[model samples]
Target: MTTAVPEDALVLAGGGHSHALVLRRWAMHPERRPRRPVILVNRHSTALYSGMVPGLIAGIYQRRDAAIDLRRLAARAGVALVIAEITGVDSTGKRLELSQRPPLRFGLLSLDVGAETRPSGGMPIKPLEPALAFLEAEDLEKPAGDAAPFCVVGSGLAAVEVVLALRHRWPERSLRLQAFPKRLEARVLQVLKRHRIELQPADAPLPGPSLHCTGSRAPSWLQATGLPLDQNGRLLTDHHLQVEGETLIFASGDCAVIRSDPRPASGVWAVRSARPLAANLEARCRGGSTRPWRPQRQALQLLGIPGSAPQALALKGHWRLGPFRWLWWWKQRIDRRFMAGFQQLQTMDSIDPDASMACRGCAAKLAASPLTAALAESGLRSAAQQPEDAAELLPAGTAGSSWLQSVDGFPALLSDPWRNARLTALHACSDLWASGAMVTSAQAVITVPALSSPLQSELLRQTLAGLQSALEPQGAALIGGHTLEARHPTPAPASLGMQVTLCVNGQVRRKHTGTGWSKRGLRHGDRLLLSRPLGTGVLFAAAMQGAADAEDLDRAERMMGSSQHPLLEELLREETEQEELHACTDITGFGLLGHLGEMLDDDCRLQLDAVKIPSLNGALELLEAGHCSSLAPANRSAWRWLDAPAGKAGPRIHLNLEGLPIGGSRHRALLELLVDPQTCGPLLIGCSETLAMRLESLHSWHRIGCVL
Candidate 1:
């Protein structure tokens, strides 16, 4: 069964190993997961596994091999993933100050952000991303004659592994380890000498591009939280992993210092603590007793050496093993096993499989024929023919020029309400922009699912905030609208998500002149250009089925988030002459081909190069797997027009599309892409070739075909 409006929020900060494990554990036991809404806030969508950092540096593994897609994991675990940086905490208010957004309120907070290394005034590799970039940019395989001397500062295991990886990449370089008077085991010292690495003094300057993997400290912001801290400035926690004095706060991994069982900062402890941390969080949320986490006193350490031959050393307590090939193999097995958990993720359907994924925005609209017939039957079309996206209602009045208005809305497609609001507002405003109207005002009509008063209020605030943010920048004020609670007498077996609509009003710049752009302005022999790619519907549908890649979903979200207002402005700036700009319309629920059919007049037939259309990154792959949008069939029904006889037609018009080069898998794939419904899709423009070139230099667009 689904949950009602949650009374509390459990916020997990950071995408460290411990938190990644916690999410994985919750995915395994969904029933045991907390009822409170879970939120995971992080700086990026993916987390780097520290165990594979050395492998990455040594060129043994690629970036993807060591990274986990936290966004996908959160979706699987039923958690909301917020990409933001946590700057500090408000202990009294139970809020977290974020870098890019408003402070987030939470009922319980957990920090597993890991630790930061002390700045050495040189290059530090504690955070991992910057260090990885540096390694990738450097020519590590250069000849010893062209290479400078290399040095590492610190006596920790990270420093040892990094230095060895560097040496393995360039054996001839003058490699050195700088340990500040700290003595190492005899075996480790011998191993360093065997690799011809010189030990340098701590006070000495770094020789070249150095990696400082020194001892780590807690984030400086933690000190300001007023929580008890260790001498090393880490948050102090009790046996139960709760902050010493703060009952609602929890900490783990390198950032937390267990007072009773003091342990060093290590990824091993973080991996081992995932279960207890997850269990304690579940128990705390349930108002039950929590168990204590007991860390191992001595953990096994493995170190890799440089060379074509696979060699590694294992150390535990005072015992040391030989630098054997089998040890390296064993470590590889462990690392791959850990990574496989993320790489081979399977999407388990919690919702009914038969329940179709809902299309949002224009795609959610009823099919054109049925809607048109209804309007015709009611004599609405006979009054003035079907109105365009925006209608010029008035001539020049004392107040302003011709007035244009259009209304658009659809059920929510995204879990993020703020983004949904923004997209919906943008979709509505596209009609005004197409008419070359200056946006004046906007009003919203929102329908929210049944929920508690406070939760419903929060949803409305978030939705309107996004709408206002998108509209105000275009100089349009949100006058106001209406809201309703959509509660059915008998609830459906499935969840009823929220929906929104925006009605926008605008004024044409010129008075009593037909200089504005519209769908009917197409000229024969003009080139067709698209402002964005297609295939969002297919990608989203694949995502609902757990078949889409995480990276693909991320790319789709970015494409949807982009506003077409800027593109509209750029096109207007380039088209000095009104004749140079032909027909223009935003691709909404209908696929590109479907929208293109609307722009065609009797004299013009579209001749498209199937290969020229652009699409989302992994769109075609999903299509090959038989993934398609819910509205695809309706859109593809346009094939009737394309197949119709040229001279025989009644009131219904035909969309003549011919000369498509479809000989291979790619051509067939593009055909399928042409009919995929788009949300905030693209602006299909028919313009002169000269204008297309000018717009091409300013934007990323495609010239798919032309009007014949």
Candidate 2:
């Protein structure tokens, strides 16, 4: 964690091969680290090693073997990893527009996004990400010839390699190559013929899975940036890889064209360019001169052929090596060597023997008992004494309605900053909603995790963008907030991640009377309505343990990040209905039971059905399997109201809804489930039974029990 804001930032636009190599070098040598924070923006959490892509398609390498985990890589480099798609660039403003978050400001920007192949019909494999997706969907065991015929388009090394791999994977399938250039070497043609692949005419129709290995083209978004470009639309750069006439902008990989030393857009040049790119970036950050990048005239290339005893075809300058078994051995060695660098970062101290995965959202909060006690000890009762969702405030102006104010913040729960920001905003605004207030304005307080200055800026930008997107729809204006680096004297656990807090101000629709729309107004016979499901705690805990299913996590995240403003707006729409809404609160860190306990009085209690309460998918299953969040024990402390131990056969509670002991131990499992903390949790509303009946018809509202 850093204590102060960074003055400068270096942003990498894409996770191409060159950028990956540059990150690897930076991770290895902290002494050469740039003063500006280094941030890598990629579409996914990992970058696939293009070198072993053919081997991956041939089933010779595992998917993990071809992937470089960008999250792990960024952590190793002490930088920030932002997973977002770059839509375009504002060259004049030095900002990169993302597909989902706010535009990111960059002091220095590098584009190594690689290139994409635009296909007339077939699927293009040049962009790598989409190509990897296509490869993953391949069904090689479809009874070979029973499947449709496969075809390859374009006459490049990538096309040949892909065709050979496809043929090897499904030998019975009829494979055809529509080589436009028709300039493959004799040895390459021999390898193709040996696989029984037919060379089709240029006009041949593409049948089944057609792999397009045509020439690479720069992304269309780059052309609109007004950057100097070659005829092919690639950003033109000088010998030092800096964009021509733009010292702050740099380009590499297939997306860049070198004016001083023109070369084909191939993985070889991208790999070789990493060294000088890293050096020049660091030099520029330090206000020093840069060394020019010199590319090799001819680089060695290894091509893989399909078969059990596959032979490698090596080519360079005017020389071509044989289809020999020894060549395959050498090719395997070289590919493995290339991949080894990414896999060799583990040090003994980096390994932890007793590290517990801390969960995000409400699970990251301190225990309520201790927090409450500390506040009481400090005599800070203003917030505690009037603990509704939002505090009543004087109207900002005479034209404004009564004002309500609240503040909320939490450590990051998701690796994606956008998701975290959106959730945080929703979580913060839920307080205002519970108080029957319409969000008017909000200010953000962000604490970025320890990363390079550039990466921190990117993280803050994405977080605020997400928050803005989530709030704007509710008619809330984001004014401004504070940004700070988390300052830790010693290294903290990875779970103590970035945090974001939003101080929200909203307008109360109803008059600011003490009797209505307060947390203490539960009626004698009101029904308690829950707006959403529970179980974020257990689900997230399972996620940390790698025990949660992807579908289950997705369901939990969607439920947790959903907003409840609309539902509250419906309940508090009319004046008569507003009075019927006796009390309201959003279940968050306190868990359902802990928060519900706060709403109880000496004269009334809540009667809940164990099965009536909604829970996130797979939450109960994980809880039954003994998975619990780090904060579970603290939340469970409130379960003592039941007067029974957790696992003792028939635990029962005598808590009365207007004086009556409900059923016994059948609710035991649900008792534990009730205390599971929530993130963007549902609203717990106390309303008339008539209104509850009306609300029960809606999917968003659940009538869990009655308040008496």
The reply for model 1, stretches above 4 Å from the true place, is 1-6, 139-153, 166-201, 356-387, 393-401, 488-496, 509-515, 639-663
Clashing pairs in 2: 37-452, 37-453, 37-454
Q: What does the lDDT come to for candidate 2?
A: 0.76
lDDT of each: 0.76, 0.76
TM-score of each: 0.87, 0.73
- As a whole number from 0 to 100, the lDDT of residue 610 in candidate 1 is 61
CA displacement after TM-score superposition, residue 660 of candidate 2 (Å): 33
Quick one: best TM-score, which candidate? 1
lDDT per residue, candidate 1, 537-608, as tens digits?
888778766777666777887778777777766766677655467778878777777677777666666776
Q: Which stretches of candidate 2 lie over 4 Å from their true place?
A: 1-7, 59-62, 134-147, 168-174, 306-311, 322-333, 344-364, 375-405, 411-421, 432-438, 443-466, 479-500, 505-587, 590-649, 652-708
Q: lDDT by residue for model 2 over 208-301, one digit each (tens)? A: 7888887778888888889998888899998889899886888999899789788888789999999999988887777778888779888888
Error of 1 at 314 (Å): 2.2
| Candidate 1 minimal-lDDT segment of 10 residues | 488-497
